[model samples]
Target: MRVGLFIPCYINAVFPQVGIASNKLLKSLGVDVDYPEDQTCCGQPMGNAGFENEAVSLAKRFDEKFKDYDYIVGPSASCVVFVRDNYGRLRIQPNHQCVSEGKIYEICEFIHDVVKPTHLKAKFPHKVSLQNSCHGVRLLHLSSCSEQNVPYFNKMRDLLTMVEGCEVAEPERPDECCGFGGMFSIEEKAVSVQMAHDKVQRHLATGAEYITGADSSCLMSQNGIIASEKLPLKTIHIVEILAAGL
Candidate 1:
């Protein structure tokens, strides 16, 4: 199947390597992937900022850009969740709703649910703690969250272990929010810092050398605290780890 890679605006400007690695990882898995040059922000920022009307054109533009592809995959679960949750509310566009639905997937979700690769050639040997982004766990239903009584299953954790020598650890609170709710962090800096501080400390408690997660947005926020506190921890995007293994 043909796939279109949707890189979030911040990731494109800041963590371009995540996008590059995502492309490489998908390609190594024998999937046909393309970067739609016309793609822009998924409008998640604006929509989350209480400006749903302003994100309409972006939603429409997004639909226009990836509508023809068999699948649209992005490295971010939050942005993908935004599209799935908010894109349909903008009635200015037709029900070109696949952009808002199953046709789009977070990278790990696609890898586990669609590609279904039983084996991989990736290997990264390190003790890593998983920071499950809220959108990935709560919104996209990527795995069995700590709050849910479902059977133990983590599509992302399972996929990350394919890297030889890589050990995935769990934080004290498995599925807590990173507090980078787009505008929420800015508007609630005090609460955000406290939440992030607690999360980082718990990850550190796991004796993990690196903190990894599916969403780079969360990594970016937590890494800020990691750097400011002079901690020995480092943040890694899952795609980067996956790409390294390949």
Candidate 2:
């Protein structure tokens, strides 16, 4: 099927490789992926800052750019959720509402829900821990939450385990926020840094060589701390691992 890849603005500027892996992995699974070159942020930062007027303009732009696609898929759950959740508040046109309401997907959830592939040609032999982004867990519902007391099922881990020799481990607090709430990180640097450091400590306690997650925002947040502190653990987007096996 033809799919439009939505690479968040931050990922476009700083973590483009994650977008590459997402595109390559989807194509490997027979998806025809097209990236709308004019795409920018999904307007999450603006909306979160109470700038709905500004956000609506960008959301309309996004709708115009991507509404005709078969599906909109991306590596960042937060961005996907932003479009799904806030586009309505922007009073998106009736004809265009469905684009935000239904046809979008975060990469891993897309694999599990849409592709539904039980096997893959990819393989990554490594000890890796999963970092659950807040938007991914709470908004996108990427995986089961620990606080829910429900059956433990992680769609992200499902794909990770499919990699030929990948070993997935969970942190003590699997779905806790990594503290990178976009503007929240900037306005509250101390709390954000502390939250990220605590998350790194839990991931490192797993003794894994790499820390992987579906959201680049979280990985990028922890990576800053890891680099500054000279931590041995490394961070990577989950799509990178899923693509590595191919």
Candidate 3:
């Protein structure tokens, strides 16, 4: 399948390694992946901040750029959630052609549910604390929660288990937010830090060497606290762990 890779602005700038690892992982699985250099933000920052006008402009730009692809995949759950959930709200005329022609997927969801790399050569011998990105968990319902009876969120855990020596640990509250809601950190620095601190504390309490998640933004927020406190935890994107074999 031909897929267009959309690396969000933050991932492109701060966590470029995750994008590179994602590309390598997909190609290793024999999927034809295309990187549209012109692709940009999905306008989630503005949309989450109540500036739909600004978000619409960026969303229009995104729709125009990736309109031809069969699938638009990315590493950031937040960005993917924005595109999947808000692209329809763009003020511009809906590119029905693109909407009908292309699909948006978070990399982990795509791999665990769609690609299903049954025999990965990857191995990570570390206890990993899984932090659920708010958009992915609460908004997309990517993970199974007690609130939902059917249990749908084990995709990440299942994929991780395939890696030899990798053990996934559940946090005290698996579905809590990391408080890295883009501008929410800066707008409410004190509360944001406190939330992040709590999340990191839970992970550290688990004695996990690495804290892994689908969103780098959340990891980055937690990393700040871990660094300041000199915690023995490292943060990684799920793709980075999967790409370890390569």
Residue 35 in model 1: lDDT: 93
lDDT of model 1 at residue 109? 95
User: Per-residue lDDT tens digits of candidate 3, residues 117-228?
Assistant: 7877688888999988877776656687756677455677877888888989978888888888888899999999999999999988888999998999999999999999
Q: Clash pairs of candidate 2?
A: 122-245, 123-245
- Give the runs in model 1 whose Cα sits over 4 Å from its true position: 95-100
Q: Give the TM-score of candidate 3.
A: 0.93
Give the per-residue lDDT digits (tens) of candidate 1, residues 213-234: 9888899899989999999999
lDDT score of residue 90 within candidate 2: 78
Estimated TM-score for each candidate: 0.96, 0.96, 0.93
TM-score quality measure for candidate 1 = 0.96
**Stretches of model 2 off by over 4 angstroms after superposition:** 94-98
* CA lDDT of each prediction against the hidden true structure: 0.87, 0.88, 0.84
